[model samples]
Target: MTTIKQDTDIPRTLQGLDDDRSSVRLRAALAAGTTPDARFVDKLIERSAIEPEFFVRDMLTWALTRHPVSLTLPALLRELRSQGAQARSQALHTLSKIGDRQAWPSITRALLSDGDDDVARSAWRAAVILVPEGEEAGLAAVLATQLGRGERETQLSLSRALVELGDAVMPALRAASTASDRRVRAHALATERLLHDPDAGFEFAIEEAKRVVALGGSGQEG
Candidate 1:
């Protein structure tokens, strides 16, 4: 395991995060979070936007969470508007982990429907986490627009996010189940199944929904 020795100088620590080795960058991120320095916030957020390693990016988010929201929130909110998809995704992810409602308004519909699947997925997760009280249904409506948007993983992510909203998503799911798009209706039906049967696997539900769609039948039929 690579380790970065404890250091007082922030620049050296920030530089460590950019090391060529993933292990070194991981250690640097861990060190930043372990120490919780405000000066490291910008570096951490910048690194998070472009970090190639998932574990390292996750650590950077952890590091950002350790800092004061007063500093991290504004930076994260700005990152949400960035052209880089990873930046917006990571910032949304960190904000979700921070659980700041003030950042809720920044979770825009454009982000929810972002062209990038990863960004849209992260936006869905973050929106579910940050949505204000009484807004779950509205958020679900927006999310429902992407029912058949991506592949299995993306569909599952959307399903989980909607399921996390509990009954609030029922209205949106119901509306989507009636969509003219077979994929959208199938996804909505499969999601509804998972919503009712928590033990049901998404793959099984989705496949069954597909079969139903192929047969020109509503997924409501057993």
Candidate 2:
């Protein structure tokens, strides 16, 4: 393969994405999106998986969104099966941004409950976006299984995804509230609180739930 030197030539755009400097790579991603080139689609998806910088990864997502879904969608779906967690996570993130319902089937329960927290969080957000109509309840039940799975940020992501499913998640939340595990019960209570009071902060709800659970209570009271 011919090496793409760092220059203004359009042919070197893919190489620009791999530039040693973060700024150049950022601009390369930005330019790819601005131009919406099919030739750049594969390069962008490739870069997204390993991009160390958060902002650049975001821009790569934006670039993928700019391309035709017919092209980007298949590439992203393939990435979901990749052994690399970041590849799966970034692909899920891009798919969520794309908002293509066709990608819904790929958001498997395994991905939602992935051992890697970042991949799981990304899967949660993507699943909420790609869940088919009338399947919210089922998705909620699946998501509910992951209660108390991670730290505050991960729990918050799960809560927000469940909240996005609306009343469909209530049954799962109620069941989880009575779980033998205090962590699961607390998270469930906090999620229920957020559902009833959208204005409530997750931290406040979680802390309150913890207090209630500490008292050997169910934490289901209003």
Instruction: List RMSD in Å for every model shown.
Output: 3.4, 3.5
Clashes of each: 0, 0
Tens digits of lDDT, candidate 2, 1-222: 223332344566688899999999999898888877778988898998899999999999998999999999999999999999999999999999999999999999999999999999999999999998899999999999999988999999999999999999999999998999999999999999999899999999999999989998886566
lDDT of 1 by residue, 23-117 (tens): 98998898888888778999999999999999999999999998999999999999999999999999989988999999998999999999999
User: How does candidate 2 fare on TM-score?
Assistant: 0.94
3 in model 2: Cα distance from truth in Å? Answer: 22
lDDT of 1 at 76: 95
lDDT against the true structure, per candidate, is 0.91, 0.92
- For model 2, what is the C-alpha lDDT against the true structure? 0.92
TM-score of each: 0.94, 0.94
Query: Best by lDDT, which number?
Result: 2
User: Can you give the lDDT of residue 176 in candidate 2?
Assistant: 93
